[model samples]
Target: MTAEEFEKEAFALRPELKALASRWLGTPDDAEDMVQDAMLKLWAMCADLRSPIAPLARVLVRNICVDHMRRHHYTLSIDTTDVPDLSHGAADAECIDRMMAVVDSLPTAQQIVLRLRHIDGMSMADIAKLTGGTEVSVRKVLSRARKAVREQYLHKM
Candidate 1:
């Protein structure tokens, strides 16, 4: 693909990429930075790109987000001291804590896939290529991951 085409497609997918990044990275700033880095990498490799670029872009974004998360050393530590008590009540707080715990419990691969597809808004085809899996496999992984999260975390709430 041409640089122009790559840029256009990357721009089109930016929002989705950012959303995925946000979920994986847990912050908007990190997500944007990861997406930018992914775009830069994609742009630099534009010459070798295939016709359908969406999957490639998604994979690139996923890789970048994972890299950022690893580099930053994000763990399951939940220090709630900084957060102020809200008027919404104790149930909301408990729910949030439970959800975080569930997210923390997920396997790394499932977490990454869930974030990229649900949070990042990436297409399954793109997720498959990014993760080096088939489309059907990616969908199955996502479905299983979602089911696990819902059953283990959300269902209890």
Candidate 2:
């Protein structure tokens, strides 16, 4: 695809990709940075891929996220102080926000797989392809992430 065509298609998919990145990164700034990097990489290889924004583009985005994690090592963390009394209506949102924070704390690979699978509604096969990992690896990461997130949720509860 030419640059113009690639730009158009990428624009259409930007929202979904941005949301995916934000969920994985836990911060809007980092998500935007990752998305920009992905776009640059996609533009560089625009001629090689076919039109309509190929799956490889998504994979590129995923890879960029993984690279960011590697470049800046992220340690898992959660702040459980002041659980915000779930009796209130806003508690649900607060609880989910805390849970998402915990999710963001996961190791990069596991975080990516988990968010892509659960939050982004991506399949195991798709995540595997995007991450260039085996299906078993994806499942294991997903399982480990879920276990950690579950532990946090239960603790908060």
Predicted candidate 1 versus true structure: per-residue lDDT over 1-157, tens digit per residue: 8877877887788998889888887889988988888888877888998667778767887888777778878687887664445575767767678877897788988888988997799999999989999999888888988889877863554
TM-score of 2: 0.49
Q: How much lDDT does each candidate structure score?
A: 0.81, 0.82
The per-residue C-alpha lDDT of model 2 at residue 30 equals 91
Please report the TM-score between candidate 1 and the true structure.
0.48
Q: Native-vs-model 1 lDDT?
A: 0.81
- Highest lDDT scorer: 2
lDDT measured at residue 63 in model 1 versus the true structure, 0 to 100: 88
Listed per candidate, the RMSD to the true structure in angstroms reads: 13.6, 13.8
In candidate 2, stretches whose alpha carbon ends up further than 4 angstroms from where it belongs are 78-157
Per-residue lDDT of candidate 2, residues 17-110 (tens digit) = 8887887778888988888888888888888878767466677778888888888897667775644456767667777788888988889998
